[model samples]
Target: MHMSPVRDDFRRSQLAIAALFFLLGFQYATWVSRIPALKARLDLGEAQIGLLLMTCGVGAAVSFPLVAVLMRRFGSRLLSVISALALGVVLVALSVVPDYPLTLLVLFCDGVAVGCLNVAMNAQGAALEARYARTTMSRLHATFSAGSLLAALLASGVTAFTGTLAVHFGLAAALLAVLVVVARPGLLTDDAPAAAQDGPDQEQDGPDQEQDGPDQEQAPAAKKDRRRFALPAAATLWMGLAMVFGTVTEGAMNDWSALYLKDVVNAGAGLAPLGIAVVSVMMVLARIFADGWRTRFGDGRIVRTGSLLAGAGLALALLVGGVVPTLIGFACVGLGVAAVTPCVYVAAARQGSDALSLVAAMGTTGLLAGPAVIGFIADATSLVWGMAAVAVSAAVVSLCATRIGWPAPEPHPEPHPEPHPEPLDGRLAPDAG
Candidate 1:
């Protein structure tokens, strides 16, 4: 009936990481749900709004090198807390920005904070999995969806009473501050080094080990060499590609599904929002259960099967050309791809911090760019073709999932009594479901 200190620590770390995930989603949705208010306040047209959104993505994409360096120097725990606090402050700034140019600058900074927190939080999640020899990433992602949904509902409720950005965002930021403080103490420290050393890339012969030099000389060289950015390994590249395509599928749906419903399916104004609602609901539900699926089928099977389901289902919906089938298709896309990014993050983190940072940045780019790309395709051709492109993105994810080297699940280790237990120091372990 009693839990060991190590087990309790694991539980606390899991909660802490989950809270960080929730904060990320909540903070993002809080701003996103208020875009209309922001647009009205700035007197911005659609094109200008697009530009503002794109700036955030640009910032996230360009943050890869910096995130990698900070993760190595500060570790994920400190970096996660710091980036999260910065995100909270930026949220407040977003509510009060005086001009469009200044707003763009703040959003760019917001994106950087988002990128940093994204990588850092996932690193913490990966470390938890490695240490406990369990699956938690999927459920942690579900908390993110839950947070977003909560923010959306809160925004709606607050809008009914008032359209004030300060009231809604101020409340959201305050909640984020509270969550950050609560999560800070429970986060694990000293795990980043273990994760990096246990990564798949560590299989290569290091200069310190392979070169015929003194330990004193080679150690400094090796340390310095690690600080420089190297090209991602083949496996890392494949994982990053999967991440890109997976996010493209997700982001395109959020931006396009409602428009697709209205224009293609000829749905009423009131019913069109259901397109987003269906996908969001199904995705949250699927993520809630996805960790179990990962445990039973392995990460490779989950990614491949889910990606195929999303691509094929959407393609069928587009071919059928009806509202009912289209909504069903959106639901399929949501349910199928819900676990893709989380699974990819686990795989990338196992490749090391550089791989993790690169893959996360790639995902940020896909999320921001995919919808715009789809818009161009729709303009050049038709909305059907645009939707078809999304299906292609999902298919690409499936294909890349096949090429990446997935780690075999580790067997559960026997229980130990050490106050500080060592991590499995390799990869995530599959558990009996």
Candidate 2:
């Protein structure tokens, strides 16, 4: 099979993007496995650790708006490359720093870099997809998930074998260096037209359409009507809610799964982390394979179906007495949540490609907020209620999907033949598996 959409020049750019995303994923949860070490080294209480981690959120939120400027000015390549490299270094710095205040500063920057890179990569990837004939978003995302899985293994192995987190972070940095060498060519220096480069061969493959609307040919208006921290468009709001619900479950698994396995199931300490790891492994696997399923099924259908499965899975985890059932429930939660988030990003980018950075900035802030709120709720109420609250939220996410901001399908105009028949302008067309 061909590596690119049609043996295209931009193939390397797509590959590079895939690699960048993969490394980003690898970095995200590596710290989770190392948190115990961090806690012990810093002599931090749970509350202190929580407060310190919250600074990461603040940094991420603060860095988002700056991405628009970075993308607009220095262009995507240098900005993204710098961010990726910076994060790897900062993570290492965080590991070695002895002072609490210094560690907090390093982590804050780490969070900012993570947040900015997320927006930049999606925007860059979406543009690259426009340059190529087929869809690359889901596959790019799959690559990221692959990296997450790798990080999970590395996390477990390195922690068990050596106490130092710096070595693993150094390896992650090395991967980022390799990624920069591979994926930075053929990408537009500015947010220039996608079709100008990739349009020669790509058949416009939007879902069925009617007569084109004014917005169809022109740029999306997300930045033109930007808001600092306002509610997203109607569709975005619903999609964000879906993410909030899904992430509630994710956070609970990350925090409370081991406890549940130990307390509820009478598992040993050694076995407890195993239960949580199993759930996380399932989640990473689902993101790799199942996330792209939405491109085939409409986002609405996937959201509706996924919610029922997720809710059922969560309920089983709560009510079922057997460990087997709980594991399966967590697996279902993973599978159900995988597609919804990627779908939201795809929708947001497609709808507001011109405002791509702004859309991502807003959406990711919502993304970060989800887990933070969940943790706070868990602390406020009992952890049991927190998990149950997550179950109920899944239903709401599926319900909200029906009302998300997908552009209304257009009617194909019979009288006029269009140059490209894509659903949105360089917004999103499905990628090859």
Best by TM-score: 1
Cα error, residue 343 of model 1, in Å, equals: 0.7
Clashing pairs in 1: none
Would you list the C-alpha lDDT of every candidate in the order shown? 0.85, 0.62
In model 1, the runs with Cα more than 4 Å from the true position are 4-6, 160-162, 204-228, 410-423, 428-433
lDDT of 2 by residue, 138-255 (tens): 5677777687778889888876777876777676666667766666664445443332212212243222112355356233322322432243445445555665565555565666
Name the lDDT value of residue 132 in candidate 2.
40
For candidate 1, the per-residue lDDT at 98 reads 94
Model 2, TM vs. native: 0.75
Over 129-240, each residue of candidate 1 has an lDDT whose tens digit, in order, gives 7777668899999899888978999999999999999988888889999999999999989767655554543434345446655455546544643753475677778888
The true-versus-predicted C-alpha distance at residue 279 of model 1, in Å, is 1.5
